[model samples]
Target: MNRILMLLFMCMPVMLWAQRLPVHEKQKELQERMVEVSLSEIQERLSLTEMQISQLRPVYKQYQKKVARLNMQNHKLFNRMNADTLSDEQAKTILREYLDRERKLYALNKQYMDNLLEILSPQQVIKLYQSDSDIKRKIRMEYLRRTGKPKR
Candidate 1:
């Protein structure tokens, strides 16, 4: 009995950590689900040819990855700038680089849209744009709900 009690006590932190593991897994699962759903909605609205779908899928994934990286970098810059340790020149340099990349990405997105349009009718392009916006809104709502807060 004494040994059992000691073992349980020693395992307490492990038990706590294990409990949190499921929650973390759930969060990751939800994020993946959102991305999949968003992509599906896009695909449905676009009604792409097999070849177009094959081409666009990778371009879309690359855009998502780039946006995520930019978001992280921007967040880090914001935190550092707010902390007052970063010099004005450093802040300006970071902001300028971010803006440059953002413009480039925007152009790339436009090019992708043009490529998609070439494969689709104008009506289909409009539908795709509308569906993309709807997906973004849904994802925002889900994020707000997950955080237990309303969007500003």
Candidate 2:
């Protein structure tokens, strides 16, 4: 009985870790799909040449990675704010970190736009931004429709 109990204990971590693998894989796949869709939308909107698509792909991927990192950092900080016993100093520190992340995000956006402009005309860049907004709005509308909820 003791040996069986010991074996279960030894297997527990592996079992839990295995269970998490699929979730991580699905998240990664979803992220990749979103990127592909966004890239396709950009191509369609801008009528990008094959050469331009090749140039834009790497720059866009890098920007996405940087933005994802900042977003994850901000999410952690935001979670820390929900702690029941958070002191004022802790709250202030989180606020400062959050603001720093926001500044970094702003700078990253500027840098991304500059990179985009190098490969695209100003009007194309503007259309790219508009496409993003439209995609987001459509996603939100779909979510609301699926959830059977009215828009707030």
Candidate 3:
């Protein structure tokens, strides 16, 4: 009984820490699920063969993950800037970093676009991009609705 109690005590902190994780982490998980749903919807719309589906999902999953990561970084940078007033020097530095991050994200997106071309036909690629844009727009709208945000 002592050993069991000791084990429980040792695990308690980890459990509490997990529960205390920032809302951002939970929001990230929710966003990831939305991405999955968006991707699956795209997949359903595509006329992919079995082999193509197998090849496409993983590459696209990476694309989705990288986009999400870059967006999170972009948001973090803006949030950090907003969290405090900054000197001209500090603001200029953060602006440069933001620009650099945007360039990196553009490059990442271009790389994935090229990668997708290697796996899919031009027509299919066009369809995929269109579907992704549509799904993301719908997801944004749904999120706004759920949060009771007024749409512009």
Best by lDDT: 2
User: In each prediction, how many residue pairs overlap at the backbone (N, C-alpha, C within less than 3 A)?
Assistant: 0, 0, 0
Query: Candidate 3 residues 68-143, lDDT tens each?
Result: 7888888988885563678888888888988998999999988988988988988989999999899988888988
Measured on C-alpha atoms, candidate 3 has an lDDT of 0.85
Off by over 4 Å in 1: 1-32, 46-52, 83-85
In order of appearance, the predictions have TM-scores of 0.65, 0.81, 0.77
lDDT of each: 0.76, 0.88, 0.85
Sort all candidates by TM-score, best to worst.
Answer: 2, 3, 1
Q: Candidate 1's error at 120, in angstroms? A: 2.4
Candidate 2 residue runs with Cα over 4 Å from true position:
1-14, 80-84, 143-152
For residues 1-152, could you state the per-residue lDDT of candidate 2 as single tens digits?
99999999999999999999999999889777777888888898889999999999999888987988899998877765565688989878888988989999999999999999999999988988898779768877987999999999
